[model samples]
Target: MSKTLIVYGSTTGNTESVSDDIAKILEKNGHSVEIQDAADISVDGLADQFDTVLLGCSTWGEDEIELQDDFIPLFENLEQAALKGKKVAVFGCGDSSYEYFCGAVDVIEEKAGELGAVLLGESLKIDGDPEPEEVSAWTESIMTKM
Candidate 1:
């Protein structure tokens, strides 16, 4: 079984809820899963010892893309996370009304790829409130990749 880590930054708890949902799905599939709040975790070597790393951060701002406040630090310091060759998946919640809907997920996905992380699946971007069924389906897709 793979050891997976899910780290998320949520303002209204939507992203955290999604993270928990993904963790449950992974656990049910016989993988060991650890979920962490981005505010409480350091980015240094964040992907170490994990077979898969899942990153979630809600998007803020109107005209521009702004990662959730708690995720800003982690995203800025992602280079130190040792993501090279690590399997990575990204998800996030945002408002489609915004110019950059779920933009945080895009940025994270790009960074993970730039850092040499192997993307496990297409990113999951939920507009407004997150739905459990959608998240579950995305997790299942990732499981197949694993």
Candidate 2:
């Protein structure tokens, strides 16, 4: 079974809920999973214990992309996470009406790429409320890549 870590930052709980759903699906699939709030996690060597790392952060800001408040510190110190050669995936919740919908996901994906992390699948972006089926499907897709 793959050891997975899911770290998420949420303000309104949308992203957190999505993170929970993903964790449930992964666990049910026989993967060992750990879920954490970004506010409480240290980015240093974050991915070392897990075979795969998943990041979830909601986007804020009107004209530009702003990662969730609690995620700012983690995002800034992402290099310390030692993501190079690790399997990584990005996901988030956002409103489609926003100018840069799910912008946080895009930024995380780019940063992961720069760190030479192997991306498992396309980033999952849930517009508005998250649906369990959609989240499960996305998790299953990532599982296939593993």
Q: Model 1, 1-146: lDDT tens per residue?
A: 89999999999999999999998888888999999999999888998989999999999999789999999999999999989999999999999999999999999999999999999989999988888889999999989987
lDDT of 2 at 74: 93
What total of clashing residue pairs does each candidate reach? 0, 0
Error of 2 at 116 (Å): 0.8
**Candidate 1 segments exceeding 4 Å error:** none
Q: By summed lDDT, which 10 consecutive residues of candidate 1 come out lowest?
A: 42-51
lDDT by residue for model 2 over 14-100, one digit each (tens)?
999999999888898899999999999988999999999999999998899999999999999999999999999999999999999
* Predicted structure 1, TM vs. truth: 0.98
Structural RMSD, model 2? 0.6
